[model samples]
Target: MAEMRLIKKGAEAELYLTDWMGLKAVLKRRIKKGYRNPDLDSYVRGSRTSNEAKLLSEARRLGVPTPVVYSVDKRNCEIVMSYIDAPPLKRFVDGMDPEGLALTFSRVGEMVGRLHRGGIVHGDLTTSNIIPYSGLLYLIDFGLGEHSSDIESRGVDIHLMRRALESSHHEVSSEAYLSFIEGYRGVMGDLSDPVLRRVDAIRRRGRYVDVNHRKEA
Candidate 1:
């Protein structure tokens, strides 16, 4: 219970900037849902808290840069981890020249590729969850991630990244995504082909759904 300052609050959790064992840390506490049964809520939160911690450690073990996990308090549904003192990639990617942007995203793609190759999928693959620090891209917030090597799961990761870029970095989305693909291919090689194909198929399905919704409208 070190002196804490609220940093970010989301629907499911709240992030607090605090010190842990005299080191800078971020404490993520899953919030309770008033509507859910108290026991169920506690169980759900505790399960997710444990799972996220495991995913973070696994990702780091696979050589992806991630914040070091300091502690986990399942009863309270809290995890205290190293605080990454850098901007999220969503903000960091802004104002970079085309070359820099390409290089940066290429690296992003490689990191993700490494994760996928290691049988993991970042369920939430948005730039907002990424940090570029000390010449490395640090992946953070594994709350939504899991160990999955299925084609659909892997495709969803790439699709989510593309959608995130298009929504947040529209002006440079296409170029950035292409560069990402290049780097991803470099690591995944033949394995990347099927996933890329799956991405295309997923995109088409999305477009079809959008068209149907438009028709209904």
Candidate 2:
């Protein structure tokens, strides 16, 4: 095992920064849960780890900006992958001018459109999962991602971001998302309007709506 520096520990996994084969890498090791049945625990960890790797590869194949997957080790329930040196978008998006913000969010929307065009839904599309690397934004953390072409699934994914932005980046969230929609439309063509309509319908069915809209209503 390479010398690892602990980066973060979440409920399901522990992230470590390490050097792999002379290249910098991130090792996401799924933590075993003691409360669950031993066999079930192993199965869950193995499947999620494998699925995450698959999702990353699929996204890359679909031309989405995602990390390079190095290898998967089911025995250790770990994934060793390229280290993205850039900061997450939550930290990166701060204090930018409105024009720069709109451009960046538009690019973000295009990335989402690319993913959806391939019938994939990034189960978690939070700012934390988006990183900027060498002037391009890359999506990371596919642990919650899934392959789905359903409009509801796609709508919900977009809706989740609307919720996240409303809760976290309230200051510029509204305008940022509008920029995203514009980019989405540019990339998705005819599909954009329907998906966005579903986004609105999905929001209406939920307990919350966009914060700005709620205020105006």
Reference-based lDDT, each prediction: 0.91, 0.88
Q: Write the per-residue lDDT of candidate 1 for residues 1-217, one digit (tens) a residue.
A: 7999999998899999999989999999999999999999998898889989999999999999999999999889999999998889898677999899999989999999999999999889988899988888999988878899999999999999999999999988999999999999999999999999899879878455342344533
lDDT score for candidate 2 against the true structure? 0.88
TM-scores of all predicted structures: 0.90, 0.89
Error of 1 at 109 (Å): 0.4
Q: What is the C-alpha RMSD of each candidate to the true structure, in Å?
A: 3.1, 2.9
Tens digits of per-residue lDDT for model 2 on 4-41? 99998978899899988999999999999999999999
| Candidate 2 colliding pairs | none
Q: Which stretches of candidate 1 lie over 4 Å from their true place?
A: 35-43, 206-217
Candidate 2: worst-modelled 10 consecutive residues by lDDT? 208-217
lDDT of 2 at 30: 97
TM-score of predicted structure 1? 0.90
